[model samples]
Target chain A: MLFEQVNNKVVRAHVTAQSPVLARRGAMLGYSGAVAFRPVRGQGGGVGGFVGAAMSGESNPMMASEGDGAVLYGYKGLYVTVIDLDGSYPLTCEADRLLAHDANLQTSVQFVGSGGVRAAVRGAMTGQGLFTTLVHGRGPVALLSHGGAFPLQVTGQWPVGVDPQAYVGHTGNLSLDLKAKVGFRDLTGRGSGEAFTLQVTGQGTVYVQASEQKF
Target chain B: MAGPSVFTAQSLPDGDNVNPYVYSIGLAGEWFISKGAMLAYYGNIRFEAVSRYASVRDFVAAQFASPVYVQDWVVAEGQGKLVIGDRGFDLNAYDLDDGNLTIKASNLLAFDTRLALKQSIVPGFVVLIGTGRFIASSNGPVIFVEPPFRADPEALLGWADCPSPAVHHDAAWMAASFAGALQGALGRTSGEEKQYDFTGTGTVLMQSSEIARADPAVLRLIEDQTRLLTDAQAGSLGQQLMARVQQR
Candidate 1:
């Protein structure tokens, strides 16, 4: 699966699945030559394991099952430019430096840049919205999403909580902190549903979904 | 503190080019076991003057007769013409003075003036002996001697915190052996740069330059001191007596 921004406001995502499968805006999945239904694991399980799996032919339950490739949704239809198989691709970008991945695909990406342009793009991807077309010439932006690609955008001040592992990308200037549940009496998994949360604060938009709860 | 310093002796390894493994004794100051002597002490040592006698030969001879705390004594003559033992000082022909009666060494342990002219009828012979408490120096070899003779062991040993020469010798030997073992364990060939990687809990990393930079003199001092202390305890003063003979 691949995603790109065109025309400055629209997000265009291209996914190739082995068969027609149901995918939601916040759905969590995996991709390797093809996209399929799979559960994302943490650092010990996700992309790291995929790299190891692809090289050794070892089975990785976190990666989307075999046969799922090339799936499309909405109205954007973009042709594939490069299919990297040798594993020599340099996935370098400004934001990649601050991003960390886990075996279960649970990780955190910090956005840092001079302006809001980068943040806007990351906000669009994490926000729950449909990307009709690609945005052009916004700025260099870094985004991290979990499982499969989804189109989204933030409209206002509503900040979103994202699963650290499922985060594909984000804008370049959001301050981040780890959020833990409050109050000791509620420590039994009752008051605080999640043990840890990634708190992002900024005026810019953030996109996240209920489906990314696993990360 | 006011008297002539007492002297204890230790042996050293004979260096290369010398046969019979000649022994060298270290006295005081830069007086080292000859570089030719093997099994040398590699640490510092200090000698104390327990008693000063005007007639050193007589004092030594008297000590030999009774031996005080001396452990062993033997008298021999002929080709060797030497009396060597912990409790006795046997003299050779050259060791006698012009009078052929008095024993004269540059450094003498004298007790009285008239004692020098006195001679024993033992023929071309000499014998000296005594014992004192073994005291430890703050940073040098430990000496064994008759205890009641000295007031303070530290003052007698001449240092406040010096380790005994025996300790220094052991440390040196252990260090040398350790370095050798490390070199071997690393598969280092002779003349090659050696590096040791101690990677576990207490790790140590060393290079050839470091080993080369160590002082050979210091190593020798420790080894010599250790050997002296051990030999003294064992009552084998071979190296100790040889050292005195060479000094004379």
Candidate 2:
């Protein structure tokens, strides 16, 4: 996929895909022209070997030694970008597993900062991976997801509280408390059943939820 | 019962005066005698004042000054005059709201129970006195008194709801109005000048030229008004208003 900013709007140029890809709503990703395309070895193996091979000369098939096009590849296919400014960019998943599973990717994003300049924080979730990017912050934060994403809000009123196990990522600092759901007579099941619930208090927002099934 | 035998006798200390002593009393009633004179009676039995005559009024007054003794009296509905000792006071069921009774005492034999008086009731010290052990049914072993023994009016008021202004832009209004008035009079004739006076109508007036030139006075009034308005807006309703503003 490839994209460019035109008239304060993001315009898609071209999307090259061997298979059908779902178009996300907010932003499009694609490559530029003048970039070479090639097959890289050792990408389908264990994590260590794949990392080693990617940095070696053997993976230099898709190279942009002289031009502006940045080369990006998936595990199974190669995407070549040509100077087709009118073509639409294809939406592709950076995760190999998601590309294979063809999972639906949904995202909730926000932009913060001042002036014409802004910082973008986009959180995306597939069935197998949770991808979040601080596209313009000091550093990017990426979290692995066991499930898809659900958006949540916590404020002074209607504070969004959740069980600890269900917590994913929170935007600001929050408070915690222990809440009980049982009585003393039921001591055997006390703190054993759905016993204690973690309460989050304070002014901020939190996102919580899990996948529909085991990842 | 043989024709009630009336025995004219002086009060005795620590002695049980019953039946053969010619006391005619029914169920659930108390008759206390002290200093050998009739003191109090709830039934046919006359209570003689043994040592000194201490009326309920005297006991209440003394208790208010310094906590003394509290007692509970439990009288069964159908039983004859049975003097039960130290079994704790039985609270009156019809008088309780939450159904719990508590009593305070200086000694095991003496205790005091305070009652909350109605606002309509006379605003003065009033109390209910009990002797020995006060007992009740399932309701309470507690007593109710007026002019509660230990309470600070100021502290109690601090916890109570207080009045506050309702406007959100009140602080801004005060600041703007005072500044406007002060600046309007900065170079005016001294005799025509005065301090900036803020009317309840949200208007500002210069009382004296001397005060108008007083930068400290103008700043002080602005500061005071701003603080008052901020405090008012932080109250419960103000919080609700702020929430509404955010939602919008």
Candidate 3:
């Protein structure tokens, strides 16, 4: 395990003075030897870039951990899955789920959520934002899951519908459409709380966390 | 070293779980899945409210027997693999070969239509009979123990082929001298005084911890149990319930 799992819920990224690692701000639990930490804004650079990322619903503050030591990156005891972005195919993740990645990865915010008038209504109803964080040209990226993250493969023939709250991210050529089915029981308050969901279609892999994403 | 593995729909496992929390069911005809348990799916599949599928009325009648929690389940029909997850609990699949197993309603994620389901005598549990496979979630890995044991009510998931346990309490708590016992029943006692005493010869299933997801069907279960109370008793219980609600 190059990026070794110190435990089920934490990962220690091997680092030296030359090759540093980028991680979530406030996720540094501890470090041995000398480690230099500097807070970085979002995918963008400084204060202006930070505000843009936030307004666009892609704000996930990060910290650069560099120098001669192994830095522990963790968040609230969440389980970490270390992924190597081979071939730089691009990886997308929920903002809160991205724990750490190679500092050289190209990170940006992609608006994969609802758009226009419908976006506003759905956003208000579902309490979901309209952008996801995209990391490209990656080496090793660590994702955090409340319980754990699981992958579901999707082919074009059968579209996958997922609970918006449980969805963390997806890859490949996938298109998303919001779907809701309000039945008679829903009106009587006896319905399952899954009246609204997201339908993803196309050739791709969808990653979802086990627990519902609470607002 | 190779890169992180990428799973395609064709490569995903069939009739099993993809991870500790996600179970992928390869569906051809139908299966009963708990409401809101579906996370995602691939291939052509449609999830209809358990009560809304009129086309499969006979099949539904044969397979789904619990009318009490009907609103908390759905039928996934068609072709493809459907993925379901439950509040991040570890999921395990069990096979019943001409056997029966009773499971906590909240813990059951999905079950093949070949198994017939019925409401268990235990208010919050359901029993599946015949040959089929079912998926269930536990707070942690399930611990199986034999009978002649006592378990905390919250940690008891369900049991198989055993007589229902007798609700047991500490002798001191039970002998709270009539009036003291009445007060204790009304909600003033140490939690440890209560447990379920199982004396039969069968396996008992228990979760590692007492932590459980909030079950909304409890209100309906209590309402059904209230049918036994006399009018006077109902009124008295209603007042007690109101007082408890207001106190909260």
Candidate 4:
């Protein structure tokens, strides 16, 4: 494994000439051996990803670490969760939740599928934006959450409901439906703060943190 | 390290904590929860504003009596495993068996509908009466201390079976600041001169950290307290508030 967790809040990545790591900018806590860091635009997601990130208004600056040694990475004292992908499914995550991923991983940007207006409103409310970043191929991706994150499986029988603010990302083929239980009382400032929820269906893994805190 | 545990609907804990920062409520009935505290849930569940829920279930109105916090709370009904969190703070559930506990409004995440909530005379705090369980968040693990000690206002979580603390000023610091105040150097607090002094029998709950969350009800509570001020005093207070804003 190229990346491993030092603790719940830190991850150490062994960087080599054959395998480099792209991490969120300013996330380097410490490093060992001969490693050099360089700025990467659009998170190395290429032009399409850059345009998508720009249109969605999600700011994610990235840095590339190269050389032979290990690099320690973390951000804002957030708990870190390492996700190992087998190239069977793509991981769709908020750009801000992303900490580090293998440089060889294929990256792209995609809109939160279907549900249109409701999904858009949910994104705006959660401040996650409409477009989400996708990481593909077999590698380890490090994600940051307020508390440590856990995965919930979405199957054919049970759809998962999640607060937009607590949502981290997801993997697999899935559909997202935004549901709001707002009533007339909500208009009078007596609304349930949990008026909106994102319903995930299909076979996939959804990541949720123990907090509604937006970074 | 092993990957995180993957929980399915059936595997999610019922009325247990998912982690130190998350609690899962086994929801068979109704729970009064803070607005936006829910992280996720499974099964059939519905959330109604406290005001609207009162119309359908009149007992709800009687149970939740604090008008200042009514807008910030909701009634979650139906069967489901509801998960809640509070900005990544440490979440701990406490059971009050026929007892009362007063807590900071922002730290009280969710409580049972069986408990009646009353506004505490102390600003920004609420008293929960009756026997029920409640979930509260602290910046860190909650610490229990006996009375006869002064607590930094920001670190205090709440007090159970105890009288409300008295505002105690540092005597030597106050004496030094009195001369400065007489020289028109108002607002000269060092941020540590005043504390909540507990003297009677009871336990005080405190957090390891001193960071306090902003309470939305504080505005209304302070506004209500303004009724004690005269028109001239109100004008002066407004100007002082404006000056503080400008300084910020």
lDDT of each: 0.26, 0.26, 0.74, 0.81
Q: What is the interface RMSD of each candidate, in Å?
A: 37.5, 37.2, 18.1, 16.1
Chain B TM-score against the true chain B, each candidate: 0.16, 0.16, 0.90, 0.93
Which portions of model 4 miss their true places by more than 4 Å? A1-215, B176-188
- lDDT tens digits by residue: candidate 4, B1-248: 59998988788888888899999999999999999899998999999999999999999999999989999999999998999998887899999999999998999999999999999988888999999999998765666767665665665679999898888755654565576577654454534456687878988876633345678899998998899999999999999999999998
Q: Which 10-residue span in candidate 1 chain A carries the lowest summed lDDT? A: A74-83
- TM-score of candidate 3 versus the correct structure, residues matched by position: 0.52
Model 3, B1-248: lDDT tens per residue?
59978778887779887999888888888898998889988999988888787355777866787778788888888999888888777899999999888888889989988998898877778899999999999765666667666655666778888888787654543354345445432333334346677786888876633345777777888898899999999999999999999999
Per-residue CA lDDT of model 2 for A38-114, tens digit only, reads 11121224666445434431221111112234211111111111111111222212222121111111221221211
Superposition error at B154 for model 2 (Å) = 75
The per-model DockQ list reads 0.01, 0.00, 0.01, 0.01
Candidate 2, A156: how far from true, in Å?
1.5
Q: Is model 2 an incorrect, acceptable, medium or high docking prediction? A: incorrect
Candidate 3 achieves a global lDDT of 0.74
Tens-digit lDDT track for model 3 on A1-215? 33776555567788765568887765654444555555455577676766668788776656676777665555654667777777435777767678888887878776644477665544444344666677888488888776677888889788898887777667777766778799999999999989988788888888787888541
* lDDT tens per residue, model 1, A77-158: 1111111112221221122111111111122222232235544444334332111111122122223332223433333365
RMSD of 3: 17.5
User: Candidate 4 — what's its lDDT?
Assistant: 0.81
Candidate 1: segments with Cα more than 4 A from true spot: A1-157, A163-166, A203-210, A213-215, B1-248
How much is the lDDT of residue B223 in candidate 2?
46
Residue lDDT tens for model 1, B147-186: 1111111112111111211111123323443575665433
Cα deviation of B213 in candidate 3 (Å)?
A: 2.4
